[model samples]
Target chain A: MRSTVREADRPWARQGAGQHEGRFALLLLLPAAVVVFGVVIWPVVRTLVVSLYDVDSAMPGSYPFVGLDNYVRVFQDDRFYTVLGHTMYFTLVSTFLELALGIAVALLLNAPLRARWLWRSIVVLPWALPTIVNGALWRWIYNGQYGALNGLLDTLGISETPTQWLGEPFLALNMVIIADVWKNTSIVVFFILAGLQTIPSDLYEAARVDGAGPWRAFWRLTIPMLAPSIAVVLILRTIEAFKVFDIIYVMTGGGPASGTQTIAFYTYLQAFSNQLFGYGAALAYLIVLAVFALAMVYLRILKQNQLAGVE
Target chain B: MKPTSPSSGSIAGIIAPRPTRRGLLVGGSALGLSGLLVACGVGGGGGKKGGGGSGSGSIRALFMQQAGYSEENIQEMTAAFMKANSGIKVTADFVSYEALHDKTVAAAPAGTYDVVLIDVIWPAEFGTKNIVADVTDRWPDDWKQQMLGGAVTTPQYDGKFYGVPWILDTKYLFYNTAQLEKAKVDAAELDTWDGVLTAARALKESGVKYPLIWSWQQAEALICDYTQLLGAFGGTFLDDAGQPAFNQGGGVAALEFMRQTIVDGLTNPASTQSLEEDVRRVFSSGQASIALNWTYMYGLANDPKESQIPGDVAVLQTPAGPVGRPGVNGSMALALTATSENQDAGWKYIEYLTSQPVQDKYALSSLPVWESSYDDPKVVETNPAVVPQAKKQLGDMILRPQVASYNAMSQVLQAEIQKALLGDKEPQQALDDAASEAAKLLES
Candidate 1:
């Protein structure tokens, strides 16, 4: 009987126990897995399927599989390139400005001062605002005949006539970027401040002892120390900036001769407004690919910085 | 705290028992039960098969959330409806104009709405999708005489009436009488585009900043304005075979005239970004000497609360075009969903809403589609000027291209016309581009 019991409790039996544990873990995760599959994976697969067809929801079941035709058409369309350029312009300009201004604000908030907490909280107020609300606020500010910006300029003797801020194409896009920077820079500030707190004072003290000035110390110490955080912020902001829609929709509606029409807006026009479901799906997938490429570039930059830090 | 030894009595044994599969099963089931409850709560009520009643069942109607279709106003109308049909209950739902098309389309197959407010452009799509009911035989023989010509024709598709026109709308020339008098321009002389330009120039000389303001924003409004202009030049958007024909003949002159209006500084350059409401604001602020807008703006422009120059505003017949006076038909209609089980009640509600009495009351906010409503003492007392101006422009009104691809075509036209207006493209090139783009869209 003792020999039988030892044989029953062998390593094979332990393997069975491990399998049971794995099954139990899978059972526990089944609900979450199902939810994710239903919501995310299924939609993505459906979009890919739809992108192959010439579908209009208005005419149900009549869609024929066009097999890469939509993709070819999108590539051929000059407007697609134009709007893509607009998207890139918006993303790069907004992200660069936000990062530069965000760093300065983060350093200011990091300094020891009275009401430091209050000032830091205040700095995040714009970021906390809803994007649609931010867009509406900016639209009103840029209103041609009666706007706060025009009023201020008139008061300051900047321009004699009420300037139509959104009436011009290039200027309208720049104005939209300014509005985005105002709202998004605070997020960068918050992240950098978190990164700033993680840096030990000993490093800065050592820098000072080594006879480094504030500027040199900032370049060598603060920026390098904030690299990981900067990378995280840059990745998040770049992705968000690339997919910018609500702000542009509310502020410009891709107007002034389609100068402000971003790729996302163009996709929306094709899908919802024009009801070209198949083409829209293809355009959306193209945007996804573009965003993925940008993410890869960001990752490469991050990897290089990490290697430099290790050195 | 209890002190226990691991060999005899561990802390796990002392405090509580170890969790078992049975416990986890109970926990998981509880979580699942809560989730099921949420799912059930969300999924319930929507799928309750609508009970078709015997002339008294509840039917839900969806309306675009706008001036005349606010919740309060709808409730008032519903109260009146319930009063007349004591057994029937009308549930009114409001969706914004932006979401109306998609929401109605998505829900139509399931009969989510009993009665849908159909835009002037959507009857073709609705008819093709079998989303709306055909009510051709339902109209009385005198319907043509009773309703305005544009209103009667707007809801017809393939020789069947899919809807009943309720909100009669057309763009009209609303000029400030004081400003016109100041510029010494006779209202009769403003019957043609050339005459309007002369008056605008005179108004500009009289210190009117924006002598003409139009809803020229690159949106649906822009298409409405363009349609009016195109029709004025005796140009049709589509040919007999329903292909894009706006590139030929009179369309070029129409676009050139639009471009020249801005080039000559008669209209505001900022009008390129102005919507109907924005144009109304300019007119109401006594800045614009003349404005072109929807019929609803008449009441708002003359409302003392809404307008600074309420006493100075007056309406004129739309300017005469090369063909005739040109106005684009923009009426919204009340349509029945094909899937609605409560078809009888839905029909009753539509009949009630579009009835002469209700339409007269509606005339207080928007113009009534019924020609007879103009003769009502209540309408006459409310606004005497609107009826006459509307009647004068009745024959001049032209319908937008009634096609399934109208929305797409409108977008292309709006963008192309806006390009011309913004100096991004020349007039002829813009029209040619619009025609080609629209052809591709329509064929697709």
Candidate 2:
């Protein structure tokens, strides 16, 4: 009976020790969590709550609860659906091109080259420029007449006439994407280059010794090892592209008949231009859900690749 | 990790585990709850600034800094106003024209500004929304009588005056005299759209790529052009009930004329994207034979430093239509906010700014609404190009629809017209669609 009582007391003592340890750990994490919640999570939660009601920032205390009426209206809006489609289309096409170009550039940089540091720094210049400045610079370049691009084309005798790069509806999105890719591909290249560095050079040497060609060695050794990093880059680029607003707003203003209006631009218009804050919030949440879903898909792909590696 | 088991007990003898998981769960929840509490506190902290005491004793005037004006103008105006009124201090916030309008719309109802300089079109919306004070009771009979007829009529909403139009603007056609001579077309004959089109064709046949140039792209520019044509066609945006009636008759006819101009190869496809500055560039570079823009372009077009076609440009009223050559009125009006504690001081500042003597001083940069300023020798000499045409167009100055949702309604109409110009939709379909959409917005 004494032994059993002692055993019972030992577990209680251990639990108290565990509780102390847990409290210490929580205390260490509390500051960071508080900062994040204050800056990010709180706004998101407030936005979610506000989306369920009709609220106007102009009339602060006049908000009345309307349940999910805003959300229902958002789904019913043709503009919302159109903008969402544009956003997805932009993300898919731009990210695909960026990944391809980024990987190609990273692979080229990985090769034994002269003045490697200088080349690497030069390649990163575009990504370092501010987005708005980049947009303005590109707008000047794409000017139909007297633009550097048209000047170059004219010099090369590529065409007899200058192109209205931004004015034409069919060409405006592509022009914007070109500007975006020019500014952002360097970032993706940096990530891919870092991932390339993590792969063991000895593995490539072994593959070469086994008579594998350059293409085979890259496919078998390089790509498999770089899958995880690529996954991260894909997720980040997709999220960023989906939230694209500044460049489009500055360049086309979603004009020439709403050809370039993306979900982000549409939300901005609804909130600030139209002063429909509730509708803006609802549209924002839809974007959040879409991005989260894509991220989950990428995570599953990462898990599968990792499992295959383990096997 | 091992799965923990619960203790089975009898009535007298039972032993229980430590229940660490449940304890951990409660602790975790408490941590999250504390985080949420901190977040709520942070959000709550930002709201206090909104409830602070309203500004008193000093009148805050929000004004636009025109492109050519310097900060000294603001200092001088504020100092002069303050010197005249010793009891009240004047504080002025200067912003760009576009930004001034946006900030007023955002901050008016929040009582951020005591007085504001609103673009003339904004009164229709701001007045109806109760963001501006009704000045019918405060304005002196003499001051009201001194204003231009059109200027006084601009700010009336529901039979009450909400603002005083202090600065006026009108659209005019700026033709290159040299280009017309080179094309061998008489300038006097270019008084109608057809005559202008015929001259433009001759100019184009004489090796000109873009014969007639205008900024027909942005919503404002489109509306200005439409206004000139609509007036010529005897069109009105509103019926007696104040409902939009622009879809049929003259409105459609005006739209068709614009479409015809685009199709006839007289206007550039790129004009669909051009703004005021771009239009100025085209005319100033001598690339355009004729340009339709505001009267202010006269000085710019004659400036050798800016314009290559100096001494070769002339300003005239936009060509006559079937009914008449109607001009669109673009003006900036001064208003006291409904929340202003210093309404008297605000009104006094506006009076100083709009007085004939001060108007003469600022005449080069602004077209003053004071009837006396039009006849002032100093003003006449300073803005000669505009003074002549501006006086003539004053009686014919047609204000756009004075509806509360003017911006939204205008945007819908412009977008549809833009689609028609771009060949995305036919003229009738675009007008019908725009009318339906505008009706929905009006109903809402």
TM-score of chain A of each: 0.92, 0.89
Per-residue CA lDDT of candidate 1, range A112-147, in tens? Answer: 989998998899999999999999999989988678
Candidate 1: regions farther than 4 A off:
A1-28, A58-62, B1-60, B67-71, B83-96, B106-112, B130-145, B338-344
lDDT of 2 by residue, A213-309 (tens): 9998777667778887889999999999999998887777676667778999888767665556677888899889989999999879876775565
Per-residue lDDT of B22 in model 2 = 80
Cα lDDT of model 2 by residue, B276-334, tens digit? 66788888988888888776678878999989999999888778888888788777678
The i-RMS of candidate 1 is: 10.3
lDDT of 1 at B239: 90
Chain A TM-score, cand. 2: 0.89
Best by DockQ: 2
Q: Give the TM-score of candidate 1.
A: 0.87
How good is the docking of model 1, by CAPRI class? incorrect
Question: Using Cα atoms with residue i matched to residue i, what is each candidate's TM-score against the true structure?
Answer: 0.87, 0.85
